[model samples]
Target: MASKLGVSIVAVLATSVGVMLALALGLISLSIAAGIFLVLLVAMLVFHGAAMDFTSGLSDSEAFQKAVEEKEQREAEHEEWEKEYWGEHHPDYQGEEHH
Candidate 1:
């Protein structure tokens, strides 16, 4: 959304201004400022992608929906496996409903 993009832009500008001020005041060395800027830039890029993807709505995409279903299926399978393993290894183990 436009609002999310605006927020991301404002955050980047604020960070840049803060870093520049710190460099100008000699509170931090040029190398440190550059390193901080680069790290922030990388983080922004990574998070921007995630923000955009989430804002755009993954439910609109069939592939994303399929992936979600697959994940749920896998988790259910894992739960079944755990139930079986615990039942076989523990004499006093009861089903989940008993808990």
Candidate 2:
């Protein structure tokens, strides 16, 4: 989804420029070029904003690694707790191993 948006943003920018130049050079009628240019310009703006938001949310390597490690640790702890609770409450749940 992100890649597609990025590609469309690039395409919009290129098309807008091309259309504007085409109109300026009198190679195409202004009315048709204007509509296409305006649409692409808006798309380019929206995608550019989205790209900025995506980039802003990115973290550095150490931070990302720490986040992943913490997530894994939390998951393991949760699984352990679930096993303890389920072992007492539903020991015969599919013949799970427990005291």
Candidate 3:
């Protein structure tokens, strides 16, 4: 969701620049530029809705849950490994453990 929104923001900025350049170069008139801008706006809204729908589907998916669990397990394993490695190497190591 956040990724889609960020991409949409970037797309909007790119579209704005394209429109401005086209108008400045006399390649497109003001009316045409307005239409193009409106189209981009509509496209962004549609993309956002689609992204939300796709994310909602994944939220309840078993595969997604399994992947999340695996990630957490791996992180825990890495933390354990880090503690052993750092604890042995630095006798006076009193740094905070990874959270």
Which lDDT tens digits does candidate 1 get at residues 37-92?
99988988898888877777655577678888999999999888877888888757
How many angstroms is residue 75 displaced in model 2 relative to the true structure, after the best TM-score fit? Answer: 1.3
| Residue 60 accuracy (lDDT) in model 2 | 66
Model 1 CA deviation exceeding 4 Å by range: 55-57, 60-99
lDDT (Cα atoms) of all candidates against the true structure: 0.84, 0.78, 0.85
Best-fitting candidate, scored by TM-score:
1
In model 3, pairs of residues that clash are none
lDDT for each residue of candidate 2 in 1-99, tens digit (9 for 90 to 100): 578876886777688778878988999997899788677767778878877776777556867899999999998898788777887888766445546
Give the clash total for candidate 1: 0
Instruction: Give per-residue lDDT, candidate 2, residue 20.
Output: 78
TM-score each candidate. Answer: 0.52, 0.47, 0.48
> Where does candidate 2 stray beyond 4 Å?
1-18, 60-63, 90-99
Write down the TM-score for model 1.
Answer: 0.52
